[model samples]
Target: MQKIMLTGATGLLGRTLYKTLVKDFEVVGTGFNRATPPLYQLDLGNQQAVIDFLEQHQPDALIHAAAERKPDVCENEPEQTIALNVAASEFLAKQCAQRDIALIFISTDYVFDGKTPPYLESAQANPLNLYGQSKQRAEQAVLAHSTRHSIIRVPVLYGDVSELAESAVSVIATQISATQTTAHDNWAVRYPTHVEDIAFTLRDLLKRPENLGGIFHISDNQAMSKYDMACIMADILGYPQSLLEPLDEPSQSAARPHDCALADSRLKQLGIAHGREFKEALKSILLTA
Candidate 1:
């Protein structure tokens, strides 16, 4: 079996990726602060440590999934964001390129300005926040280093979480309650995708020889705002939807795109897709959580 090395194995999407990919390929997981016994403890920011880890494993493909994902946190800690998002990623790409290891970099759809509705893989990146800018830089570094690398951009993710607040989508459950009023953003459009679907997409993409080292978009087609999501969660959790209030203006401190609907044309052409109904899937997740 071809060995796969995955970073951020303890994270939301990385956890799912590890679980899904391990079924086919030999997956070696790594984490920094929360790493367990099986998952190697390696800091991506440490150049020598990362180099040593890569040389030790010599994986067929390395999925660089570790990143400072929160826009607010990234905005507050610009240095930390650049170190992890840009520098670490650039280092990994260079190391992977030298070793001839297929590197799959996990990226965010926030790379676009959201002026356009659906962005193709070839769309120019015009990030509006530090978080997006860092990822954009990383994307450029990866592509510059090797054609053997791939970048998979996904939107807001929701999935099996250790806690309710773990994912942006699942965290909506926290804001909702039966007796109290809650407010959510109705202005910014979001495509909340399941992490498992992204994992499955990567699994399928790895099997195909033609599209192994190119840009791909993986996201759910269902478009909804935070208020729309809150309404659905309220219904599922038996909370009154009437208590929910929609804010039709951008309220967050970080500048977010209005709508960045990723058009997965490449995946479509390759007949590679995996998705779930947002309502039903989220019901199962919320109930389980």
Candidate 2:
């Protein structure tokens, strides 16, 4: 079996990716501040520490899953955001290039301006916020470093969460549970994909290394805004929908795209896809949470 080194193993998406990838690959999981047993501690922001870890494991491929995904937080702390999201990525790409290790960098659909719908893999990136800008810069760095490197862009994701507030998707339930009067942004659209589907898609993609280069978009087709998600959660939790309000205009500290529907053109050609109905899946996750 091929060895794969995964970063951010203790995180939301990282945890799922680790569980999925380990079934077929010799997976080496790594984490930072929350590092625990079975998860090697390594700080991506520290270049030398990262270098040493890479040298120690020397996996066949590495998945850069650790990132600052919060737009508001990234806006508040640009230096910290860029250090982990951009600088660390560039450094990792360089190191991977030197070691001849295949790299799969997890990215976000926010790389686009959201003015355009259904962005293709070849689409030009014009980010609207610091978070998107950092990921976009990191994408450029990774691709520029080597042709063997791959970028997988996904949209809002939700899956088995440790807490209601852990995932942006599941956080709707937390908000609705706290107060039926919670307000949500109705302007910006999102596609809440299950993280397990992304993990499965990646697992399948790993079987064909020849198809692992350039950019690929992985997302569920169902589109809904925060308000839509909250309303659904309210219904799921038996809360009154009347109290939930929708803000028609931008309601976030950082500007977001209106709709960034990713066109899974590359993944489509490779005959690889995984998706599930929004409401049905949400019901199971919410019931468990």
Candidate 3:
């Protein structure tokens, strides 16, 4: 079996990917601050530690999923963000290049400002926050260090393993199950991809290793606001629509991307089919959980 080194194995997406990838690959999942499958206490900010880990493992490929995801945290600590997102990625990419290994980096839709809807892979990136800036810099460093790299830019993702899972559709389901009235009235538009879809897509991309040199946008076919997404989740979980509360835009503290949808034409062209619709995906997660 091919050896795959996966970073951020304890994170929401990382856990899901680790579970999916373990079946087919010798997955060595590394955790920065948590424990999960193939767990390693490897902090990416420590260059020598990362180098030692990579040199010892000598995996066939590397999947960089670890990140400082919170925009507010990245904003507060820009230097830390740079260290983890940019410097670590650069080191990993250089190491992978030297070893002739493929590298897959996870990026976010936030790299593009909300002014443009449905950003393409070729679109110019103008990050509005420190988190996005860090990811953008990481992407650049990876591309600069290695040509055998794939950058996947995903939209708002929600599923069982996600940090926002409980607070997302799961929250509504739990509330409805407990007969508690809940309101989800936030008007921020985004294409929320399921974690399962992302995992599957990454696996597919891994199979065709030659397609490892460009950016690809992975997301659902349709777009919806947070309010709309909440309603959909409620309906899927058999919650009454009357219990749903829609909040105005002014209510949110973080600067949101009003229309951060992505066009998955490249993914389709690569013959990687989308897994499920947003609602169907949410229902699957709820049922499985």
Candidate 4:
């Protein structure tokens, strides 16, 4: 079995992938703040720690799912964001290159400035926020430093949360479940891709690492505003739709893209199709959760 090491093991994507891929491969997952069985604590920002971990584990592949994702946090802590997102990414890519191990870097749709409708893998990155800039830099590092690497770009993600209000969808579900009225931002459009599908896609990508290398977009091919998502959530949970209200997009310190929907034509050509529609995926998650 291929020995695989995954970063951000305690994160939504990392934990999901670990649960799905553990039976198929020898998986070692790592997290910073939280450490559990099969997952050890490591500071990715510390080059020595990362190098030592990689040398010790000697995994055949590494899936980099760790990042400073919050826009406000990234904006406030630009240096820290660079430490984890760019420097750590470059170091990991270099180590993987020397070890001849396959590397998969998880990226984001925020790299685009939301000027275009449906972004492809080849689209030029024009990030609006520090978070997006950090991820885009990490993508470039993977491309420059790694010999065998794949960059997977994803959009707004939702899944079973370990904590309350982990994702926007979960927050919506929580708010609507308790209160009769809830307000949602109607401006920015998003593609609510499920974490399970991304995990499944990574599993499939592992089967053909060579073919899947380079940049690829994998998102549920549906575009809906946040208000629309709230409506769907309300409907799914049997909550009153009348309680949902559209509110203007709140002013933010960080600039976010208006629309970051992705099209995976390349993934389809490679026989890797996204699993389900947004609503169906959301329904499945709600039922299972």
> How does each model score on lDDT?
0.94, 0.92, 0.79, 0.85
Name the lDDT value of residue 257 in candidate 2: 94
lDDT of 3 by residue, 143-203 (tens): 8877788899988777784433433445545544326666664666767777778999888
After superposing candidate 3, which stretches have Cα over 4 Å from the reference? 162-185, 236-239, 287-289
TM-scores for the candidates: 0.99, 0.98, 0.88, 0.93
- Regions of candidate 2 where Cα sits further than 4 Å from its true position: 177-180
Q: lDDT tens string, model 4, 165-229?
A: 67766666766643567788887888888888999888888877667568889898677877898
Superposed Cα RMSD, model 3? 2.6
Error of 2 at 147 (Å): 0.3
Which run of 10 residues does model 4 get worst, by summed lDDT? 170-179
- Residue 155's lDDT within candidate 2 is 98
Steric collisions counted per model: 0, 0, 3, 0
Better of 1 and 3 by lDDT: 1
Return the clash pairs for model 4, or none: none
> Can you write out model 2's per-residue Cα lDDT over 195-219, one digit (the tens) per residue?
9999999899887888888999999
lDDT score of model 4? 0.85
> What tens digits encode model 1's per-residue C-alpha lDDT throughout 56-138?
88999999999999999999999999999999999999999999999999999999999987999999999999999999999
RMSD (CA, Å), candidate 1 to true, equals 0.7
